[model samples]
Target: MTLKYALPVIALVASAAVSAEEYQAFVGLNADHYRASGDSETNWKLDGTYFFDKKVTLGPLDQFEYINKVTNVSASFRREFDTNITRIGGEYFAENGLVVSAAHTRASGDYVNEVGLGYLVSNNFIVRVNAVKPEDESTDFMFSASYNHQLQGNDYVGFTAYADDEFDYFGISSKYFASLGEGRFIAAGITLDDNDGSSDWSAEADYYFSKMTSVGLTYNKADSYSLNAKHFFSQNWAVEARFASNTDDSTLKTYSLGVTGQF
Candidate 1:
């Protein structure tokens, strides 16, 4: 590869090694192969959340900790195509069902900041809005709302709407679970994404042999399909593998393997 592309990739890999996400933490690597381009990439990711349950005074300022029932600090790093993206954020959770979060992200040499507010309207619905500002770029907004209702054990239907600068879409998704045997269960779901002019849909089915092992298949209206499998060695560690392909122009394909751990 040319030096122009190589330097950024090297820097990203180095930066990701030191930086670390969710209330659940994970680190993983992905090996990806592109069929059409005959190129391959190895991606590294680290992210997780650490929570402070008790109030601890930090210097002279308590900030919002007085009203914060739960303080969660999160960090994430992604290294791909020889470039690095890093994010650090914190969330303040209040007992009155309000959550506020702020995060800063850096990519290459540019930076962006995001602020988000969310509320749990009820047990089945949530509304969220996020404002994102990137240095030297136009500020953008994203809004999302979702509602889910359970009909029986582990079976439910849901609706979601999402909007951003480029396009707005809304759709419904549902999961219906059935017992296959003594310790096996299967689930099937369908999702539709209605864009500004056209609509795309996908269907998925997953079979779980136990609580920790499952395999799934997905077919999208975009003439793409994927097969995926996951196995958990323990409560804290798991691995995943997937193969995907498309039938459109270029007929691209990909294969990937990754592992994750929660702390």
Candidate 2:
């Protein structure tokens, strides 16, 4: 609309062209949006990942290959009610000509493995398949497809709808970054999720004190408030911790800690 916002959009376009090289490993966690009915929630996760690049080597015919393993645990608690989860999965990424991937995931209690896929368009757009399997209840099938669109202003909006237990959701979000003197910055954003027929709104902001450390705060319908802190050991490694408390007339609170690294 205005130059103030146009400049940021141009910057994103410039940064988007750089093709990412081989990816190895990464891990991180947060404790926001921790509840289902707009109450307080928190949990921790420990993850280990090993995988290869997803980019294709376009020749006479495109080709690529990579596989990975991941595992993590998360538990939620309140003054009384609680639900805990453990997840483990394996994935394969292959590009004999067209990119194809398959994955299996399992979570504690009743969470089951979900499967997904992607078809690339330009440098930004993609099509994804999200499938979920239930472990405790009568099998529920969610066959959904979605598109990701990056706006000229660098904002993102996506849409999705399902078949059985049918519903559609629209999400839109934009980010703002402000320099707080010296080498520090604060990034904030507001997100709206039109899930089913209800509209939920949330705003979050994080202060990056330096290259090695930062903290964040979030206010969402699910969690009244959440606080997070992160300390980076290197450009590729970091550790994080978070605590969240419910705001509604519920007793759900969570604390999570985790380490993340790229190698």
Best by TM-score: 1
Local lDDT at 127 for model 1: 75
**How would you encode candidate 1's per-residue C-alpha lDDT over 36-151 as one tens digit per residue?**
67666666667776666533321111111112346588788888779898999998766777778899999899999999888767657777788899998887877877776665
lDDT of each: 0.68, 0.51
Clashing pairs in 1: 8-82, 9-82, 21-47, 21-48, 21-49, 21-75
Error of 1 at 252 (Å): 2.1
**Candidate 1: global Cα-lDDT?**
0.68
Off by over 4 Å in 2: 1-23, 27-44, 54-85, 90-101, 107-111, 136-165, 168-186, 247-253
Estimate the TM-score for candidate 1: 0.71
Tens digits of per-residue lDDT for model 2 on 94-148? 3431233433444444456565554544333334455666665554444444444
